[model samples]
Target chain A: MNAVEAVAKPAASKEKRRTFDVLEALIYLFAVMMLILIVYPIYFIVIASFSDPAAVAGGRMWVLPMGFTLDGYQELLKHSNIWIGYKNTILYTVIGTLISLAVNVSAAYALSRKDLAGRKAITLFFIFTMFFNGGLIPTFLTIRDFHLYDTFLVMVLPFSVAVFNIIVARTFFQSSIPGDLWEAAQLDGCGNLKYYVQIVLPLSKAVLSVLALWTAVGYWNSYFNALIYLKDQDLYPLQLILRNILITNQMQSSMGTGEAAVIAMRLANLMRYSVIIVSTLPIMCMYPFVQKYFNQGVMIGAVK
Target chain B: MSQSNAGMLHTLGRIRKNWGLYLLLLPAAVLLLLFAYIPMYGVLIAFKDYSPATGILESPWAGFNYFEKFFNSYQFDITIKNTLVISLYSIATFPIPIMLALMINQMRANRFKQVFQTVTYMPHFISTVVMVGLILILLSPGNGLLGNLFRLFGAEAPNLIGSAGMFSSLYVWTDVWQHAGWDSIIYIAALSAVDPSLYEAAKVDGASRWQRIRYIDMPMLLPTAITLLILRIGGLLGVGFEKVYLMQNNLNISSSEVIATYVYKIGLLSSQYSFSSAINLFNTVINFILLILVNQAAKKYSENSLW
Candidate 1:
């Protein structure tokens, strides 16, 4: 096929010299349409957050902010619990990412070694949980038995190492870092820990960055753990707090009536849009910076 | 006997030599045991009449009482029907991302491709709580963007979130919106790995753009697609509990009550620990069986398998 194409290239080029084609045009059109569909809701939320609550509720606000006001943000910021949620979430993400990365990366490195005794068994031990689990009740029982319920550590400690992540990292180590490198390091009297820390760690920047971003984002957005394990409002992450607000608003809008109902409705409308922005702003801001690494990271992890 | 002894000695020597590596694995092993394996033992509580005072082990045996109760309960048919419907709905939407990736891959401009990819993948990072919140806000019948759009066209917007009929579509489509771009990443990666020379050959053969895609790109993407499809089918029953739980309301409970959410309600809220555990165990068993069967089928039909 290559030889045939090489011989026919000149003739084909002469006939196919049209710069634009219907297919190309259609592809571009589809891409633009999808871009709008994907981006418009997010854009709407941002604009809606700034619009007046009544205008927003009345369907007046669409492409632009209607009767622009910071009242929603003002009310949200004034609520001290949102600040506490932020503080708790930031702490969880930071500490949890570090702990997760350490546990996952080290485990991955160890399992990636072909010479490691019982490597296959160890990997199976981890992967088995992906298919079947104890389900919700038993897991809750175990957490309670460990005395981790309502504790801050319950948020960060339990469920720290993701098996999927470990597998991805292990696959990365196997493919990217050659066996010869480890052998070479051993020849230079570099012990396992030293070699891993100095050489392997430095060389694995892309995977490490990907793992860090994934772990950090997961911890940042997680609400399920907080919902199940932590009952104390003081320890609640931002998602839980936002969730409470959203549910309350939904309840109020559906049930409430009279003057107080009207007031509650407006507040609910404002908070609905504002809370979306508040909860997701940090992650959305960080996404662009990490977008470049995502392709590389996802490819490495997903390929295997 | 000598060879077996030598193999044992080799394993022992390796363990002794790489003690540090074993030490590194210690924390993960311990954590997995405590959190994953220990809870697995808790699944035994399903077979027993679990009492908080007696703990999981000491509870008296109830044989198949809880399981029978769940199978015979009124919630049984509704929950299973809802679970299968939603799961099948989700599976149906799986190819949207593939189509998106194919469209993105077809684009000639590099800059547009990068921008489109970045913008589309952003939603995957949004928390489920926030995602549902956005859905509620945007679909709010009176004041939401959907309502406003309907009004612009001289019609009232249906209460989309409140309508039982719309629940599954809303859930599936919102999921597609949130995850399609992120999911497309793998396909894009797969596409990039396709041999460029194949495209050149097809071009010289006077193949149209559609023909090139049909003959060249589709073949290259099929293996990855099949592997992913098998994996998706394997976990067909394991619909995410978070978003569904968040989006669930009294109006849409008929369509939204999945096994996971039902289990949470029964086990945690209603305190039917044994019954919920039995339900969960049943769900897990079905999922495991499906996974193995799918994996085996993929292995037989295609070269790609998860194993």
Candidate 2:
């Protein structure tokens, strides 16, 4: 989309432009097909989320909500765990972003410095971990070892510094921060600490915001660690809770609809779509605001 | 001051100067060292009969034993074959994004185009579990919209989700539809960076829009495209696991059993930790070799590589 807007230079001679009429029509046809392919399923899911659970299962849903209802949302809301999940997700994303951004920026700044001791070694050390790591059992054991296995710390602490996020932050610091500023800071007896906190952090807002958003999203969407490490229901994030609901729905749907449990399970299955929407809605709302930065500021900031 | 004393003082002064920054970096450093690096050391379990009761220290030495077991496992050859082939299928479909970006680039900059682009990118963010659910709901043989549509056209509609032959193609194509637009963000950025002055010059020389794009946009995108291609190659084996896992049933597990799913079955479900670790270790080794080779190739070809 940005591609079309950015590269728009109106062509000469509408006739010449329309000369490849067959190909133009063909491309438009294919593009429309692709658009529908991408859009319709998700649109249907959203519609299904509001449809009467029984009607939807009877294969009656399409573009519009059938037997219109918000009962799925109501049912999902009644479960207090959903709110707990939302609270945990929000807390994790917000706090995790701050912790990660603080650590990543400073590490990136240190790694970006020309005169910093062992800068190359530090960068290499960080990058080395990206390509190889121990499998799940050992990592799970480590979480157990730290006694962080079921706590919220299991979700946030271990993944605080994503290597890619660090690299992007480091790249920005290297080019955007300007070596002359550092040199001048040193000359003015402004210590590295003051320069980083006072000057660098202030100047680094755009990329910092982008990294913060990425970290927040990572924390938001993460579930596998929660699945493995978390035993307690209270600690389950939105995704984990949603997965549980989905599995229960599957089991319910599989029992072939005669029993009272099956009827409730069918309601549970309808709630699956609603739960998905609920879990993703918070982050999606936050995304457009962060995404605007990615569209404009981050590109300029990214390239130094 | 004496030379050695001054050198020692310089080292200490440097450390003192950067102490605050070190303090800032300290938490992440400790986490990565403990969580990420320590696990690589724990890869030693592949060579031992590991027990959670005894821990890494007291685990009996097995020395090439798990790898031997994995190599001899009934599913070994098929898992490798399946993983590589599915990834190869993914690689083939990669250029669809380039084409989509180019097509979108050619469209007139209108509200319709913006809506179209937004629509395309939206699917990329739908959670994988939901995506598989959507696929299952939409493609069910007897009653799904598509299947029912096919029956109306006087044809027998097969159960797509149940078909092993359709699995990889369905996985790859669905991935393409979900991701192609979002992935085009960088290429779009690259396209925007193309010098419009070049297009103006081309127009003055009687060049067509197609010719101008062929000349300017394609060359501009090459660097970005090459960089992304290298990264994709580096990540060839590490396909996202959730969707495949969700999509699989007993009927289709034959083709759907890639290295990741196989590893999960072996480690998580079967508790063959050491053997699965060996398999994953092997996967990482292959990925490492590809990253280096592809990074070098990108550097050679386009002067754009991740390293």
Candidate 3:
């Protein structure tokens, strides 16, 4: 290459790099602004939860907690229903997730085996539910008819068959698990049941954990079932209890009058922030670690 | 005849061989039959005058009476209009995640990209109950953060949560905020699949970054975008019940009352089982038909479809 050509190429590339640098900077600026838009509200809530109710309402608790206090948390913890809600929610999430994983994973593994009979027909049965369903009232009636209404079993048993979970797990099994392993296991005198339990599941930890976390989070957040089916307060989950405190109770408090009204409103406001923190902090804390596995599951599902 | 008999025998042999797999599938099959299929059968109540004491089977037939009632009712137009408006509004903002993914993919700083993604996805894990609660607390005109901001400027905060005009915006925008980062994952996956050599080739050819993104990334993401768009369109009428129900009040009821909440009120709250079932059945049918139409259209016009 001649000197003039070499000089021209380097100059041209330099201009390109300059443009890229400017564009990259703009992208970063936009991302950081978006990040702050999301994170600031959460940060404000944390500070406001600790700040005195009057200071928070008076607009003094901006950058940091002004006249910091723990009355909100103290009040929230004192509410007896919250404890019951927490116990019920933990029980439901653990038991419901176990049931969900058991049914979904087994069905997915069965459907994933190419050697399985009538696979296409069975798969279509599950997929059809994704397109259409019985809607709300009928399902509620079905639950009631089965005597699952207003029971602990109602929270964990009836709604465990998630077709989307089945599809995702099936996709994972089909793509990630080797057919060669099944053949080798069969040669080693392993039956289908033993092979799945021993060989397949052990190798599928990433997908299993992903499914587990998703189901657990789902169960933790679910309240509509409780809202519609259960009348018994004893079986109410955290989301239902939180809803009563955060939304329903706020209305009742606002309708009151005089000094009591003002006090009730202030306490209600304080307790809301605390309740949010209590309900979501566990999930948020676990989110960063479980995020990659979720992405992995999504990637596997998307390959379809 | 002999060949067909042999084929039947082969199928039976496969079934016999896979009895263990069949056993594994039994739990899910039974659950779906109980929860999914039985409810589907119970949907016959829409065509019958369902009395709880008499049961669905013994309830007298109502035929098209409930369907006609729903069609004539004022809520019919209101709920359909509200559902479509909110759904279309959400669909219009569909490009936001694609844009977010493209921006994140363009970032040369890996550390910043990872951090940005982590922070953004955090909001999605916030339960619907907590999310609406946050909306209420932060938007309360009497003493929320927005109220404090307004006070800083010597003004009162607007009644955002109670305004009918603001309801759809509140629902759609908050939904976007919570989900856009999570939704961008699929596009990000698609972008990562683009051959690195393609980027290198464009760079060596002296293409600018904008040009590279336009030529390389956008095209790669189109199929996934179309697929997701189809899926969204399929579920257009199926707006969520929880958030809208929680956010609702006397003030915003005109705008916020969609089909799901309407059915809940009429069926469970009012004890008009047959009428509510009709409305719900209508909604589900529309959703199913729309999905099929969109999937077919996509398959015909392009290469992407759910099937």
For each of the candidates, the C-alpha root-mean-square deviation to the true structure, in angstroms, is 3.4, 4.3, 3.1
User: How well is each residue in B1-307 modelled by candidate 1, as lDDT tens digits?
Assistant: 9999999999899999999899889999999999999999999999999999998778899999988998999999988888888889999988888888888888767798888888889899998888898898788777778888899899989998998999999999999889999999988888888888988888889998889888887887888898889888988889889999999989999999999999999999999999999999999998999999999988998788988
Model 2, position A76, has a per-residue lDDT of 86
Q: Which 10-residue span in candidate 1 chain B carries the lowest summed lDDT?
A: B101-110
The candidate that achieves the highest TM-score relative to the unseen native structure: 3
Q: Which pairs of residues collide in model 3?
A: none
Superposed by TM-score, candidate 1 places the C-alpha of residue B43 at a distance from the truth, in angstroms, of: 0.7
DockQ of each: 0.74, 0.42, 0.77
**Model 3: residues >4 Å from true position, as ranges?**
A1-19
Clashing pairs for predicted structure model 2, backbone only: none
Would you give me the overall lDDT of model 2? Answer: 0.76
- The model with the greater lDDT, 1 or 2, is 1
Over A174-235, each residue of candidate 1 has an lDDT whose tens digit, in order, gives 99999999888898999999988999999999999999999999999889999888889999
TM-score for each candidate, following the candidate numbering: 0.96, 0.90, 0.96
- 10 residues in a row with least lDDT, candidate 2 chain A: A295-304
What does candidate 2's lDDT look like per residue over A74-134, in tens digits?
8887899988888887887788788888777778888777777667777788988888888
